[model samples]
Target: MHDAVIGGGRSPLQPRALVARSWSRVLEAGLDPDGRHPRDPLPMDQVLARRRESPVALVIEELRAIISSVADASQFLMVVTDADGIILWREGAARVRGRADSLGFEEGAEWTEEVVGTNAIGTALAEASPVQLFSAEHFEAEQHPWYCTAAPIHDPRTGELLGIVDVSGPAMTLHPAIVALVETAVRLAESQLWRHHELRLERLRAVAAPVLASVTGPLLLVDDHGWVAHTAGIAAQARIAVPRDRRPLTVPGLGLCLPEPLGDGWLVRPAGGETRIVMTLDLTGPPAVAVSGERPWRAPLTARHAEILLLLHRAGRSGLSAAALSSRLYGDAEHVVAVRAEVSRLRRTLGGVVESQPYRISPAVEMAVLGAPAG
Candidate 1:
């Protein structure tokens, strides 16, 4: 593979190792190189809906200015896709857009290797790396006229593969630096995404501070999928398995307990022991929770408020920054105003329990989960 030649000559007739591999995979999948069109293009409405809900939507929005700045005078088109290669957004020169539309390269088109043969979008995702394909490097005869560079974008928090961002234009427009340009854009998008997550975490930390201020024992805060967001008193060696479904299970160290629904996740505490304090998170209707200890109290929480609390609890004493909380809450860290306003309301509701300045819960409190054994 190292010895394989990359694009250089006037015509990109030579297949790089990665492109050659993609060609092989395409052939094995039984796609015809002469196929006139790709398969399973989503409807425009569906594509718009997906874009609205996609995690990368905000990133793409933020990149609009950068995209225009970098590609305004060029024929290159900017494309964003979901991990599966469904194009969610495409923007560029009108002439180039028309050409791309003729080739079924519009939004909602699926460009997976199995569907579209060897192309930059599918190949980059398949190889999990940045890729540039030019002219004859593409397996499909029709795609040979196009040159494209693409790079996969990943979740900043979980490192999960989110999708790919690509730049495409006529083969004659190919530049050696296009690959680097696409890579830079992907990095900027990822950085923006990270900032958003940090903001959301910060908001959560603010809400959890009050709840945490009331706890005084080993505790763990986990999201709906059981990913630990925060912890206290529990040793690092303790591995707790949180069930995906709402079922009771015996966790190591914690004993038999069912996860109680809190915010967007579950608050797991021991079922039986010298239980001195109790917190009941009622998610049945309008979100509400009750904390009982020396200071018995209950508060009605809005859905957003509940989510903030859960994230804060998960963050534990390390706390969360505004950027982190904003990302987690709204998928965009730039929504700092929303986070601040929400935190303000939360403080008013919970009183002096929640604190600011790198938001975190008070150490004087300990949160423990308690649930009845699943039937």
Candidate 2:
């Protein structure tokens, strides 16, 4: 029920009296005649669950270099606390560290805003701001002797609150450089964490390249910022070159530009800040689209499906008979029958739009847009 008096001691103020006054204010302002505070409290089960799952040590080694550097240069002690306020790591003077731990302020102790009321470490996290608790400003009577400074550590990329970095020792001995020092150190730790995750994702993608190519079809892996990351080898067959020009490349036939380079031969489409992979066959071999009365519809062209279409476009006529077209296409009678069956399936799929007429392909319904636009 204590009012929290927060901030660095800027004026000529007695720290203990400020704490007492703040406490009295909070109790008087918050409590009704029934002595109840009008606020919904969080469930302890959910709080414990979130705290247990927090991974503070995941980047402890990376952060250690900065924490040690800060602690070694400053007279104040440095400690890393998990999201739950449990001190996970420390680097500072041995004397301060010992005294802090002896006062039940060591690793595994929950010093969260909820548990300790209002203190430098807990309050910094609650308010998502840097805090400086001078002597006697701490919520608890026992903690009144020490002053503490803390800042919330966040994942640089995601901006998620990771933990807290704090420096604590005796109060009344204020140093000018403590706040800036802790803030800069926390920022460095966050930068390291982001770099670590980025490297990890890059390595994982490299290892999964082969399998990713096979299952996801031809694709291009792009970064979050719309730059092409990976291009598949098969993409070479397409007119568009993979890793093209160190930027997003245009698809040869499709009217789309990929965000990231398709190193794995995949192109991702961006819509509303979301990326999606689109699968398309390489059409660089030849134009497969044909026009009406262009070429006689061939029964089957095994090797020349693409080339034959081009030839048919140039010559305005129907195609050869099944056996004849087969020989013309691949020079085989059995293959001609197979091609005919495939063409039949194509007709079925095309429905009434495309018609199979002897050795000719005709559009049952004239399409206003057919073949290349008349030059």
Candidate 3:
């Protein structure tokens, strides 16, 4: 990793206009826009201190491990920065540690675009690209001695920025491989972020079921493209009659469907009680954005509410009866009445948003209720 940082890769071909524009932006902003130090200013003590307050430190540590394995160079230092430019993680040679530390290049120091002007980490974040800064190209005199390469890290599904991965070393040793190495690290981090999102959403889906039992009908989990990810037992059985692979399951033609693509998944039901109860769900492409847990829906919850939500998730959103809900909670009709009262109070609190209609839970309520149970 160190070697790659020092003598790693060729920089991207610079477009004359772009280079001029970038330089113009720098010159127009002048040397100090924020009135802070012109040099990179993160320190090791601060970076270490930030671990408690920031999650990016852990992410950067993983990036360091990845870069070290693929690039394997000593002079090369791998660092992770937040959206604001604070260095969250840095792993490199002891010789350069002083310089890095002096710049507040450690975890807690802020390295946002505002602080460092148009440097690799800041610029890459602004442009959302892989950037290389060698020697004289650095905006600040204090940053002149190092060659730096950085790539933006984005969450795959939502394409939202997570942070950046940067490698820096002595100017003379800058190489072409640095860009590739940084890109590789960024991609790995993105993959990890996406997987984590999916698992979290799935857990929410499982938890929301019972709470929503009184809302409406079957609870269904569909992908962004309309494929089914999961379904309550009732929905599964109802859908079993319909061909699962039939493309583009249209609601009016076959059954009712939610119009919105919620991250917690769609809450839905058959428009008619006599309808086959069968619905088609698409799970064919990349996991749906709704399944990634990026957008969470709020559900009205109480202790009894939570119990009912579980039953709804396990059963269907047919709106469990007081007896059924009570059985789940206290295994007796009297207790069930008490729980039912709680549900009634919760219903009023959630308003029409809870969607109690047609003698059951509404599809929208089911979508939110069956997806994320109250903590």
Candidate 4:
């Protein structure tokens, strides 16, 4: 047992450094190497209830056909687990399913590292990345005959870990390419989740359009979690993280403000004003714009918004018309409405610093590039 636990030489099939560290943790938990690790299965009714409530339920259902095809060809057991590492769903060839069942790999079984040693499902969840474990690499002696590859799936909206998708089979069936296959499947699942959010955003946009037409000042429509679903006077960046609480929140470029409950999320309005607002644009990374002086605030800009702002800043006294800006932004003069919408959102964040008609920055506001000297 000691020799198996602390081998001197590294085998070609040995676990990666991260997996090895996980194995150490499993041992520290005092799980017996030879003894049968107790199975902690949730009640069948409870498991069914939990699966129904899971956000990934539809995603997993849609991927079933693809997962079935892979399982049939590779003789691998396909398993999906919740974030807690409890098996929520399982599908595979009859023989593989039978073999896995004998080892307590059925639905409702807990496979967290502390509960079941360092297997692919648990380790992938722990590391929040794709992983593969072959034969002896599995910390448990009983699991030594199996090879497994798994990838962590994340909630597209919140970027939170949702669950894991794993493919496991006999060690002799190990194929190095299985890791990539599992990762690809995970990506498809995440994309499906993203589409779900997009659909919800579209519905929210419809509801907001009418409300926005009434408001004269800048306003935005966000989801229940503070993610921007659509905007009227605010730049519709990919997302805006607003505080979940009702406390006064500080917005970048727009000083301290209180969020008023509107539709699914809150409508933010600036509480104070700034005399001299200096805006900094950093084009290298995510392209963020920071407003500095007295009460400082900053916000990230989408690629399109960043380009429009840069063009306007360079225009100086000669502002660009909607048609000219449309051609520059979308390569078509017909997209004037789209150009106007973007400018309106930009104005909301920049306050009176950004002007329309001929889109241009306000004379009082100073614009600076991070790597370049302040102008």
Best by TM-score: 1
Candidate 3: segments with Cα more than 4 A from true spot: 1-17, 32-61, 69-73, 202-216, 220-375
Q: Model 3: which ten-residue window has the lowest total lDDT?
A: 239-248
In each prediction, how many residue pairs overlap at the backbone (N, C-alpha, C within less than 3 A)? 29, 27, 61, 6
Q: How would you encode candidate 2's per-residue C-alpha lDDT over 104-128 as one tens digit per residue?
A: 6765666754455457777777677
lDDT (C-alpha) at residue 297 in model 3 = 30
Candidates ranked by TM-score? 1, 4, 3, 2
Off by over 4 Å in 4: 1-3, 6-19, 235-375
lDDT of each: 0.72, 0.53, 0.54, 0.76
Of models 3 and 4, which has the larger TM-score? 4
TM-score to true structure, per model: 0.64, 0.47, 0.51, 0.64
lDDT of 3: 0.54
lDDT of 4 by residue, 181-295 (tens): 8888888889999998888777877766776677666655667656677555555565544443333344444445556676666666565464445678888678878876655
User: Candidate 1 on 1-375: residue-level lDDT in tens?
Assistant: 212322222443545678768877877898776677546688889998998878998788766766746665788899989988999989988889999988899889999888888888999889999888878788778888899989899987767789989899989988887877887888899999988766654555565667767877666666543555567776543234444333333444555444566565456666444233345555566777676643466778898887776777678888888788999898989998789778867755653234466665444334442331222
Error of 4 at 75 (Å): 2.1
Cα error, residue 325 of model 1, in Å, equals 39
